[model samples]
Target: MSEYRSLEDKLNYQFNDEQLLGLALTHRSFSNVNNERLEFLGDSILNYVISLAIFQRFDSASEGELSRMRSSLVRKETLAEIGRELDIGELIKFGIGERKSGGINRSSILADAVESIFGGILVDGGFLNASSVITRVFNKRLEKLSSDDFMKDPKSLLQEKLQDMGEPPPDYIIISTKGKSPHEVFEVACISRVLKKEARAEGASKRKAEQKAARIALTEMDRDR
Candidate 1:
């Protein structure tokens, strides 16, 4: 009967306290009693679950490799991707201003909401249930992860490529930022002066924006080569 019944179905878990689910989907822009705390708790829970899963799945992986893979898996981009898959953006409760500014599709908001849902599940059901849900949701991603690709992020790879070509590293500059705290959107430009190339991108955070910009720059560089 709850409007969130569909989300519960996607998560494959029902909450005894429907309020918890509501809170998980509530953004700070919507209310003071939002999902930040839940996001923090869920971040930790997600890391643990993913770390354990990867550790077991890739038994031959070194510690450094495992760390890199975990970082890739737990990054905001990955979380945002998962959130999109679950259509979480549509369910998020945002403030009028945020909603008007397209907060629903914002990566940071989506990622935070996904984590908060995990936290809510932990609080409502227990670690077992929380882990079960996490594992189930991430099962395909875990299976599809490749050791060769997970070692380095886009930024790192771009930097290394530039270095190999005897070019200086790209500089990430914040072009502009919009919105208020916890819901801000940042536009960044990754400029490679030596290569005479530049790429611009927007994200919910500076680092994410820079990463995206770097990825674009990398793609352009590769295409030109």
Candidate 2:
């Protein structure tokens, strides 16, 4: 019924409840009409699934520890990775202007689509089916992120660094977010804790944006040493 038909075939999964898939493919910008509800359900479902996964995966983890891990899992950047894997980016529907700007590949959009897909599957198939599919999609990410390298995403790492320095911590300012909800322009800056200076970069999410800024700041800080 739509371009997403190709994507459905690609993911090696089909929905008897085709409407759910349709809802997932629809973008909020296309109209206020469809996607918002799915996104909402998807968001909650994702949180529940991820929390369960974290709780079981790390039994010794503290509440705060589990929370940080959950945040790492559910962030826009993480969901975008799942969306990209399904090639959902190419199949998404967008408004005309948003389409022209390449919104489909955006981290935020891809992330939202991941939620929509989760919500859709839950509606059509139930939590078990939705969770199975989502788990399949997230398995590799889960494994990789569990590694030491993912100890902190760029944002958290920067915050920790600032906190260690006894500073107020860096805050993000979005300079530009173009394209569509998915593949848009996202130029972000990190405001200094003390100097009030700012460093900036373009990335798909706030984490990425902040990472770039932090990298710059770290380099500058080292230089002064």
* Candidate number with greatest lDDT: 1
| TM-score for each candidate, following the candidate numbering | 0.69, 0.64
Worst 10 residues of 1 by lDDT: 216-225
Off by over 4 Å in 1: 151-225
What global local distance difference test value does model 2 have?
Answer: 0.74
Backbone clashes counted, model 2: 7
Highest TM-score, which number? 1
- On residues 32-103, what C-alpha lDDT tens digit does candidate 1 reach at each position? 999999998899899999989999888887565676677668888899999999998989999999999999
The lDDT of each candidate is: 0.88, 0.74
Steric clashes per prediction: 0, 7
| Steric clash pairs (candidate 2) | 103-183, 106-182, 106-183, 109-182, 177-185, 178-184, 178-185
